[model samples]
Target chain A: MSHGYQAVGWSPFKKRYDLVLGGLLAGYLALFSLATLLLRPEITAETLLIRAFGTAALLLLHAVLAIGPLARLDGRFLPLLYNRRHLGVTMFLAALVHGALATFQFHALGDAPPLVSLLASNTRLDSLSQFPFQQLGLAALLILFLMAATSHDFWLAQLTAPVWKALHMGVYLAYALIVAHVALGALQDERSPLLAGALGAGVVAIAGLHLAAGRREAALDRERRAAGADGFVEVCGVDEIAEGRARVVTLGGERVAVFRYEGRLSALSNVCRHQNGPLGEGRIVDGCVTCPWHGYQYLPASGASPPPFSERVPTFRVRVVDRRVFVDPRPLPAGTPVAPAVVSESGGGG
Target chain B: MTPLDVATWIVRLAGAYAAAGLLFALLFLFVLRGVDRIDPSARAGSRGFRWIVLPGVAALWPLLLRRWLAGASEPPEESNAHRRAAAGGRG
Candidate 1:
């Protein structure tokens, strides 16, 4: 939301969020380490720390993955979604600590390099029970490293938002690798039903939440409005949309948000330019349509961000006739300014 | 080849790719060209920003290199369902 990029874009809210997260992370690691020590005094410090960080990372990864579906299902969790990159980067750091320590402990003394030893030492492909799982963990770490490196808006702007998003979608692949790494490595070694149960529960919970959100989205897409002659679709009653708000309707395989403000109706593509956020879900602020995800603003008339910002979304011609809002299914070029259809002008077939 | 041998080759190849990426990033960030031409916002990005972006540059060096070599001065236009629909208006 700025013309220029800063190192970290540090803000008051980000500072507070990071502080709270730091406190929680430290507390969790301390508690895990204490519990492990009390339960097994025979364990060495390195082993204890590795397990503590590894479990912490796994738990954090689940939280990171769950936050998306949770936010989609409920707006209350949107704050978590806002700074999820921080959560993901924190998870990667925790995982890096676990990986570095484990490598040092397990392979440092070998004649080959630590990475070489890690890859060459474990060759138990003969049995599923003894398969090499460190490779899986390492692979996941590499993906996370790449993701964390490119998490900033600099990359988003450089690579284009869609490409950046596609790259970050590697998170799902990393998640799968991590699940396999744990199920085959730690669970095999520990042989603890409780551990197994926790893993299963996490996977199920994440999957279930995603499916629930997907169902809700599918329902929205199903309510596509029937278009009439002149390529205009009658979406909803003008009274249905509150002032400074929008009613999103699917038309011609695209979602358009018809917004009402100051007795005038305007239509814009539902997608925001920054992150493809739902502009329909956001309300007008300071006479501008503000995005719900990151507050990226666009003018309802031109579907363009105000001066100093060049981003734009497609604007559709819209009018209200007989108190029913009708929008043209074909969108105008982005940033094209069209006179808003006033309520009184509707009688003239505006 | 055995699974282990296959894995070792993959790891070695990836490692070499990363090493090359890191070296290329160092030159690209410092000597090759200014980011202002590629991206205006990165005109005077901070040291911390450059350090943080090293891994990303290492990972996507090939793409960046191609863009840089081709003298691409702006980011590509994003295409999506809405944009595709809008493109129909042009046709």
Candidate 2:
């Protein structure tokens, strides 16, 4: 809750977070520069900066990508997810510096403009061994610049969350571009096993984390599908859903959150409207289903945000028979009001 | 035209577009209403927020225009009880 945005809604926590980040970044650059100067004294200062910033940006990008899956796997990593936009912006700046230095070093003072020079300097598009890796890097940088520019809440609001999310998914494309950029550009020039191994490990770590998290989510979906039948899916017994908690069931390829609150059962789409957050993982706060990711709330019965907030999610029809909860797999339109099923006195204790 | 000239022209055009976009974004921030729907905490007259989001709006103006034209910023209406009943409402 901000009533008005400042440059940033900085808190003590953010200040400390930024300070630690800056310290680590400065330390990495310094160590990298020192090592380069000592070990490879023949390397030019410009080359040194390029390599240092490029590697730093690559590492930061890895950290940025890792934070999402890490937070999903462990709650302790949620703090990193909170201020991730800042991390992304910083990574872009580092990448920008690397791009600037590289362009100046390689393409400046030529007959053609730097952009033209970059494109034409190496037209070896036909061969993988001699591919124009700089162009790949430039493409990735453009994507980063776009993402960095829009890494703000205002854009999220302006573009709508779904559209904004889809746009940012371009990061994956940018990441692939960068991997090719490195493999065909820097790694080709320098045949260092250590550098190649680090890049491979980073790719493996990112891929492995995403796979693990996806498998976990898939297993939950499998369990739900195995228990249900036909269009009406049997979720669980009323007693299984604790008061103010929910049991998430996957029906018809979508996750539905069946929540029990005040001895009433209601089901709504599991995806949070704000960031596609898991609503089932969140508890009902103030008579609304609050997303654990950003605390955006929606009324369980109507799937509407409380007055003054405009977000909504699809609601599902739920009924209780002999303490077993059954949900209609077909979803009603977002914000559709559905009646809550009242729990019988003999059903379960709240 | 040679490949070099074509590439140079493309770069120049891109630069011009970026400059025009920045100007348009500034105008949109100052002149338009109902543009800032994502952050309720953002004050309508906050120059700080405007400056922060200017670059993003410039880069993504087309997407923003589509959203604005589609009336995506408007708040969702509360469904009436009769309408809810028609949709198979339990309540």
- Considering every candidate listed, which one attains the maximal TM-score? 1
* Each prediction's DockQ against the real complex: 0.55, 0.33
Write one digit per residue (lDDT tens) for candidate 1, span A1-350. 53766778787878888998899999999999888888899999999999999999999999998998898899999888777889999999999999999999998997777887788788787767899899899999999998899888778777767787888889999999999999989988785598899999999999999999999988889996667877788888877889999998886576788998888889998888776788998889998999887789999999999988888888988877888888888878888897887865345334
lDDT of 2 at A153: 62
TM-score of each: 0.94, 0.86
Task: Point to the candidate with the largest DockQ.
Answer: 1
Native contacts retained, all candidates in order = 0.52, 0.39
- CA RMSD of all predictions: 2.3, 4.3
The DockQ value obtained for model 1 is 0.55
